[model samples]
Target chain A: MADLRINLAGISSPNPFWLASAPPTNTGYQVQRAFEAGWGGAVWKTLGDPIINTSSRFAAVHFNGQRVAGFNNIELITDRPLEVNLKEIAETKKRFPNHAVVVSLMVEPKREKWHEIVKRVEAVGVDGLELNFGCPHGMAERGMGSASGQQPDLVEAQTMWVKEAAQTPVIVKLTPNITDITMTAIAAARGGADAISLINTINSLAGVDLDSWNTIPHVGGKGAHGGYCGPAVKPIALNMVAECARSPHIHIPISGIGGISNWKDAAEFMLMGATGVQICTAAMHHGFRIVEDMIDGLNNYLDDKGLASVSELIGKSVPRYSDWGDLDLNYQVVARIHEDNCIVCNKCHIACEDTSHQCIERLETSDGRSYLKVREEDCVGCNLCAIVCPVEDAITMVEIPSTELPMSWNQRQKAIGSMGQNEAPGAKEAV
Target chain B: MSDYGLFQEEKNRLDAYISRQFKIVGITENLSGATVELEHPGGGQAEVRLLTAEGRKYMSNLVIKQFTAAN
Candidate 1:
């Protein structure tokens, strides 16, 4: 079997999968059960001043027939007392000595409070500490979670305070509510964070009850915005991870979170620069046993890829991700319909004729049967026709080799600027 | 006519100028399209407006080739 073990900035785990600091890691019992079920690590739920939670604190966005395609929560940090949580952490560590147990912390942004909490949590013999700067709903109202997280200076100061007393590696879990995530990531690194994790859920509301005219998961007939997570937010989260991963200033191991459901998502995050992945929504929807399939699938994938360790996947695709200006403008792909695989469904033709460039033409064959063909010269290769095709391999995007030298938009602009006076002969008359 | 036909017509116009020993002097691009200024050694000048993407790409290729050859 390929080695699945990973060490994220010195916090070693049996595998790259860790339970995010969410409801699943709220208690030692749940975390112990998760570890027993084959999770490599767990970031214990954010522990600080205990706060009472409401009854209807959770809601889900179910897309089409998929259940819990996206999950939203207004749930706050651990409601249990600090002593109780600390005792559980110490006990859990003693039990799962080899498993990684990182405690997430959040308190008033004060130096003493940070020092005291860091010292107390580290005293429990935990493997690491994740500064929770990303709870975006209830605690944010009190200027604690996303409130402190939104400000780059606050993130840096608070992280610095935690690092002052933290013996264990400190990971600053970033909030995605900001305009640019790299701003806070760079702040965390400046504060001497050992590693960083993102993205803590985006601000979202699940939906409204059209019949009742009330919001979904309304507590006492009222609703507030919640933090959004789940498969629906994967693309957004992946882009943020890629943005931070490709940044030059932010150099820290990333513990990628947000909508990581299965092994494929985990591998994608790792390839994009996450050293380890913390998952919650999938575990919450399917229970802790889902990690079994994740572990097995990842093991099989690594072995098939001829990689000896899961760590080999980290940051492998970062070089492939670049700005739009760097992409070659000369490269082209045109849609080609395979006649054998075509289902004779007019979805591609209709999509092309109406929304896209009028390229795919509907024509009768020699036998008077209908078929579609693409006018290659006019087809812009937007991939809309292929996307709407129901049958697999019916419409394929084939790359067209260019005869000219490869050029990028940046290069093209530079070349245009090099030519001095570009004023047309009849430009004044045309204007 | 299709866009390809327009591009072919414009490409032929450019090729006609090139066959007459006309050298590209100046080029301009705007919302309308790219306009190439060609001048022959015998003191004749002509301009062609390329509206299609292929035509513009063809013009850009020529400009890049001239730039590379000059350097």
Candidate 2:
């Protein structure tokens, strides 16, 4: 396998995959097990002055047959005492020197509090510090988390304050609930953050229990919107990461987060300009062992693609993305169905007849028999019916264009026709 | 609505060239929207239908299905 080692601002890791600061990284025990399982690094769960957590702090959304999505907590940062967390950081760093152990912090929005936290954490041999300026729920009500990140001036001031007191590298994690990600990223950069990580979950209200007239994960029959993360947020995270990477003002190192479940996802974040990829939901969903696949898959993919190093793939796709209207206008494809395999279900027929292009043609035999037919001119190439069909490979999309004329296999064979029906593949039946 | 009107209004435009392009009989086709169905010359049936609501327009993309009888 090709080399997967990466160095972000002098903090090196065996690979670019790191655990995001969430439940999985809430303690040193969890983090050590994660490293032993092959994760290259981890951001210790957000730590600050101890705070209370509610008993039932979660909700979910289901789609199709899966619990497709969810939300988290009335919980605050790591509830463990600061000294205990510090002692673990020192031990974790001493035990695994190669892995990146960046301490994530959030406290009262005071420069003195940030200054003290950075100084104390730096002494633990930690590789870096991530400002937890993006937690959207309980913490924000106290003028921390999203409160600090939302105001550009506060983002800059708080980042600058920590940078001033820190010896270790500082990364500012941004919230997705903001208006423009670029504006916040620029603010972080201007404050001298060594790098930026994003996004901390989006604000969400999971769902409602209509009879009780209360929101889910309800406490006292009422619930507030919580921060949303998991697979559902990956696209939004990717878009924000891309915006930061492409933004002219901020070109610092990036640790991408949001719904990264496997190596392919980590690789996409790298290609979009993140030097490292941080994951939370996946680790929560499948347990820490997933890092084994993440490491193996990325390494194998690199070897197959002939890339000798992880850095080779970083930000590679950034240049290909451009403003809208620059896309090619002539590309086209047609919808084609396999005849011998069709089940003759008329669901597509009824759907198309009443609601769509009215492009379907039903025909009867010369003896007054009937079947379905397609009017090619009106078919717009939507693959919806294909998705709803139960048969496998029965329907497929085939591309055709106005510029290219049609070709008939029978006509070509007829033009070269000298062979009688007696010797062909179906000749016996014809006779 | 008349099923025959739907078929003729949909297929009349493609009558001249479709048989040459795809070796199939035009069964029911709607070019204006997602409701179109066709049978390939090889005897497979294809159908198109609408699935979701479209924004800023009267239609969204069509769902196309192909089928053959199961034994």
Candidate 3:
């Protein structure tokens, strides 16, 4: 069995599956129950000034036959008084000494306020601190949460204040509502953070009641846009993790968040350089029991791949994630139709004929026999034919070797620059 | 049309000499095969139904082939 244990910036856990700081980790009872259900750790829901939650705090969006594909919340951080939350954190840590207990905190972005909270939490012997700078809703209006996270300079300054007062490792939980997440990520690293977690949540209004013209998760008759999460936010979160992982400046370990719901999602994030992953919506929908399957599937996958440790998977795919300029322009592939495999489906022919390039040729023999053929020269290798083909393996994309040598746009630029004189030298000859 | 089997191998290659002899003007699908309209340098227009006995013979581009272009 592969070792699922990870030391995320000096914080130890039995596995990489941790409950994201949300309603699921709202209290000591919830955190202890999640740990009992096989979760390795929990970032206890954001703790700070107590706020009253509205009547309707959550709204979900369903598509087709699926439910809660996207979730939005008008909820604020732990509505419980801070002293009660702190006492609970201390009790939870004492009860589950083996599990990771990282407290999520968001307060006024004042130096003294951050210092006071960091000292108070670390005094309880919490494993680490996750600064919740990414909450996109309710609390943001008070000059905390995303208000402190969206600005790169504020993220850096606030992180610095926390670092000064923190005894344990500090992980800055980033907000995804920003224009460029990397700016904030690099800023956190520059502020001397121990690690980083993302993405807090996206600003969204789940939907509106057409009949009432009121926003979803409405308060009485009106509503305000809330922070969006769940499976819908996973892709956006994954991309942000990849962007940070690929950058040389942001060197801190990333705790991947957003729409992560299962082992595959966690694996993708780890491969993109996340030390571990946090889940909220999945646990919210199915309960913490889902972590059992996640742990089991991840172990099986690692052992099958012959990996000695799970940490080996982190950042494994970062080198391959690159800008479009580096891709080879000479690479080409053409579609080929298989005779035995085709189920007489003309879907591929029509797709290529009308929607895409007119590369597919339909032919008929005098004996009343007919089939299709691809004009390879005219094929742009768009894979439209393969996508539309109903039969398995009916259409295959076959690679054609580049007639010339490999030369990317980046290389072309360098070769042009080396010429010294601006004669606009042909890249094929120059290289 | 489900009458003929697709060319399964590299045999699907276009014949260089035969392809150069006539330029394909247009192709339309019908009962027997794809009706290919070709234009010769002599300003002559001819239609050949491909994926058939005669069409297969012309595609070979190797054998001593004869073509009777339908006016």
**A370-430: candidate 3 lDDT, tens digit per residue:** 7899988678789999998878898999999975455555654444333231332353354
TM-score of 1: 0.95
> Candidate 1 residues A342-391, lDDT tens each?
97889999998888888999999899999999999998889999999999
Off by over 4 Å in 3: A337-355, A358-373, A384-396, A416-431, B1-71
Worst 10 residues of 3 chain B by lDDT: B62-71
Q: Which stretches of candidate 2 lie over 4 Å from their true place?
A: A340-431, B1-71
After TM-score superposition, the amount by which residue A271's alpha carbon in candidate 1 deviates from its true location, in angstroms, is 1.0
Best by lDDT: 1
Where is model 3 chain A poorest over a 10-residue stretch in terms of lDDT? A416-425
TM-score of candidate 3's A chain against the true A chain: 0.91
Ordered list by DockQ, greatest first: 1, 2, 3
Task: TM-score each candidate.
Answer: 0.95, 0.74, 0.80
Candidate 1 Cα misplacement greater than 4 A, ranges:
A421-431, B19-23, B40-43
> CA lDDT of each candidate?
0.92, 0.75, 0.83
lDDT of 3 at A285: 93
Clash count per candidate: 0, 45, 8
lDDT of 2 by residue, A301-408 (tens): 999999999899999988876544443223345455566766768655666677765665666679985555666656666665566657887677777754422223
The two-chain DockQ for each candidate, comma-separated, is: 0.49, 0.03, 0.02
Maximum-DockQ candidate:
1
